[model samples]
Target: MSLLPDSAVTSAPGLRRAQLLLARQALEAILAAQRPADAILQDLFRDNRQCGSRDRARISELVYGVLRDLRRLQAIAGVQADAGALCALRLLDQGLADAATLEAWGLTASTALARRLAGFDPATLTPAQRDNLPQACHERLVAQYGEDATAALAQALRGQAQVDLRVNRLKATREAARQRLAQEGVKAEPTPRSPLGLRLSARAPLQNLASFREGWVEPQDEGSQLIALLVGARPGDTVVDYCAGAGGKTLALAAQMQDRGELLACDISAARLKKLRPRLQRAGVNSVVGLALPDETALAKFAGRCDAVLVDAPCSATGTWRRNPELRLREPDFAALQALQLRILGDAARLPRAGGRLVYATCSLMAVENDEVVRAFLEQHPEYVREDAGEILRAAGADWQEPELRLLPQRHGTDGFYAVAFRRQGE
Candidate 1:
């Protein structure tokens, strides 16, 4: 593909070409579906030890920018969707650079191509292309939220996500954690929704901060914090995080229990359970008991015992598109995912005793993964009745109007999340 005119194809010097080459390599690897964009970039940086922080930053910016706006960039760049042209088009489209400066970055595009990009019209592309989402994703979102709202949601996800942290209440109060982060040169403000959450204005090396290393805070989205809150696991209550992958919610629930009650963190992977050991110690939590279940059937041991059971079932993770844009490019089997979600929710529901709270949640925007799964599980389990999630969240200091907790990026300034609280009936 001839994206560059003869005049624009000059030999750019060493550093510029190297940056462009690295960016292209990362983008190609991501598009090839080998691994996540972030992982690919990590490998690239590790292999090229000479790349400084600034070089890594530039390469990452280009790679993510292209992924976030792949379909739109493809529409603008036409058939010549090579890495150089797409990067050049993305830069120009973002007003980051002009056509004249493109050659300096070792990105070249023909004058006509540049002109077409400058006057690119969204009307010329299909709705899916305009939204830069896969056709199936766009259709599902549109079916649920209508066209205009889906467009807004898609656009919201195209931007970068803020770095939010959940202050580990066992270690320190939110205010104390904020003060500690400030001392480490990281600025943060309280999130609008989550009472114990802090939102960073920009990305920071949080792992290096003394507060983070001391377990004063954990990197969690504000929406995720709210999900934990919805569980309403109080002191001395037996709570179970039924699908604790890395134990993020398990730690939060443990803190809510004030290190008093029995908090069981269950997952199918022992490897993932192992990762939570140090985090539990760092947060000074003592109530959590990490359990690796052989499968969903293993939950039978806790049947009709716990006061609260949280099923954070895995799905397509569509709500995390802002952080993982590649999700928008790939299509997941919604039917299969919904089946798995229902199976897990049903298995977990048995753990909650009569009148106990059972909460189901997912980091997904699709109804099949969220509302549909909840509806299916409730239909099969007559003892469980859906409760108003908004009421629970409101009582916990976060005001939500809907019956369920639907945290959207376009509205909530956090990652997408859907949660519904249920109550078991009868003895």
Candidate 2:
């Protein structure tokens, strides 16, 4: 096949090819063991110094897109379809691949494989089987594209997610950030619930952007911003951001307090806390006192002193699957994560003084991680009562409402998040 001119390619074809290769490598790494896709992508980009920005973007997109739809694609192609073959099928479905492209890459498009897909009927597959299919198949195309057995195998594939940023209110307003971003050729709109949130129309290289460099905005999901908002850290309040990795929400809390509160940001990781220092400085957040805890014993020093504590606990980040689609591939292990959740909750709860509020938040969609964890914590500490998360947000001046403060991408155009606010019964 003749090589098309630069204009004929939707994206750079050369970059696409590099991305496809890296994506296959990433899949192989995942099959080897559980690893975060973002970390893997960063390592890949770092190793291949020759790869440019466009190549990195294309590779990351292809890798994540395939991961998100791996099961549906596998079911369509047949259960035993390996990662490489499945990725090829996804490219074909997206019209990014053709016979000539495969041939040019020295890949032989097996006639048997093509024939099997040609005769597949997706209508016959069960819902479970369909869900088990690869991530590349679309719901609408289930009938036409997955004819033969492929149609029955096609499941709903999650679409591309927008990049969200939380405007550093300590440095700039949401409107001001939007205007600044516009000057940099980045289009963004205000998020519904977050006073300082903006959702970018498309993912752009932000590392070099002036707004980011100036710390006017921080890359954070809208749902995440809402979690910090639920904390209700008013000026002069003493607050602790437990497990404040890199101080994303901690910084947000500092902003909300208008730099008048004493915000102690504590994390187990010294390295992560060190990184926050520069960011805190750039955001002009002077109220946050970064503390690197050696262990639980170190956290106990601040026990019963904080007026509010925000525990953005660690969990399987299932709610963020849209941005990092590879999360759908994780095998759910409720028992292990539940135990860790209990530990974090108990530890974080210790920091709050009597009558103080504690906001439990997770980027997990699973009830086991969110509601169950909160329920168990409440059971252990009868002194604490569940404050209505919705009520807290309303009091904070949040317009977009929900009963449980749960945010789902399909419903709210944000990452899946679950937050619960609690207050101690009496001082």
Candidate 3:
């Protein structure tokens, strides 16, 4: 029984105002607090259990819309931009609100706000400003990908990400899943890069769909689907999904193995892993053995035994900015994150046996966390040799053909992902 305010708020206009007020409260709390955006929303909705679906969606959109375009809205509205001002700028920019409506939303009217955004052109602003990217990170991208591509990525990431899903091969084929969605009056198309990936053109209440509830499909980005495919786990093989948060790739790998392999999903946080349990059951996956580590017993149980180990190491999550712009609000300590990546890499490498594969992956666009980490790891461990990541993908029939696997959001229509593989040569 939820007590969240329902949509019965007087009239349509009043409903909008109520939702906007909720959004403002949520935004302020999210910005000031260190907790993740999703957690804040969960708590907010839990307390306001009577908030209807429409109210929830509207409130969420306002919160995310402002967070995504936070910098641009602040610039347009000047330094005095609060949630009201930011919301007004966004609504006006999207043509959802006029000056009067902006005032109605509790934003003070200013000629500067109107003038700055009138007939706005992205090309007029500098690349970083235009793309709304952090300047230091933008500079790093410029150094690696050059100015043009970096700008393109920023623009691409600023757009709303398309909904992508992985057709669970264990329960349904891609063709069958597509047919099911079509039967339900949902439009979907196969993703370009991943054979198992489906792209949804419009948002649908997926949880209500029989296909999703039956685990015929699981929502996953094409980039993430590709990473799971790249793991290349086979039946009867011992595989490790190191740092498996929520076990998205774990479920995919279990299906890849036809549920016949020893698949250990390892993570430092048991709570995150706990959430993976029901999803695994829904997907009918039975092969994955969850192991929370730095537990010496668990580490010893799997040490030097895995045929393939996926070090999906923690990162800045720069690649996922399209869906999660809240990342831009805070700066993670790169030095500390890098040190942790190194330690995790060393620990994960210990799980792969001689001649086994080590696939290091991150959903990050930064060269510091992507290539630099791999470079440092290789220098420290001479026994391990770099494997041709692109060739491995090609062998699996992916169209990627570079020396390493670096999929850019702008070019690949997928989140920016970096993956490099290594093999311990003993065979």
Q: Which model scores highest in TM-score?
A: 3
Clashing residue pairs, backbone N/CA/C < 3 A, model 3: 3-50, 4-48, 4-49, 4-50, 4-51
Ranking by TM-score: 3, 1, 2
Query: Per-prediction TM-score, please?
Result: 0.90, 0.86, 0.91
Those runs of model 1 whose alpha carbons end farther than 4 Å from true positions after fitting are 1-15, 95-120, 295-298
* lDDT against the true structure, each candidate: 0.85, 0.75, 0.82
- Model 2 clash count equals 22
Candidate 2, residues 1-427, lDDT tens digits: the string is: 2122345445325435545667778777765657778888788778887777666766776777677666657766675477666667677666666645644554455334455656778776665345543332233224433444333222222566678999987778889999999999999999888777899988788997989989899998888888898999999999999889978898889888988978989888989999998988888888888787756665677788888999888887766666666665646566888898898889788778889999888887667788788889989999899888777887877765665688766667777788888998875
The most accurate candidate by lDDT is 1
Query: What is the RMSD of candidate 1?
Result: 4.5
Off by over 4 Å in 3: 1-15, 108-127
What is the overall TM-score of model 1 with all chains considered together?
0.90
Model 1 lDDT on a 0 to 1 scale: 0.85
lDDT of 1 by residue, 1-427 (tens): 2223335434431224567678888787777774777888899999988887777877788788888889988888888887777777776677655666666555656455689886987789999998888899889889999999999999999999999999998889999999988889999999998888999978998778889888999999999999999999999998999899999999899988989988999998999999999999888987888788765455666789889999999889989988998777778889999989988888788789999999999999998898788777878999999999888988888767788899899999999999999999988
lDDT of 2: 0.75
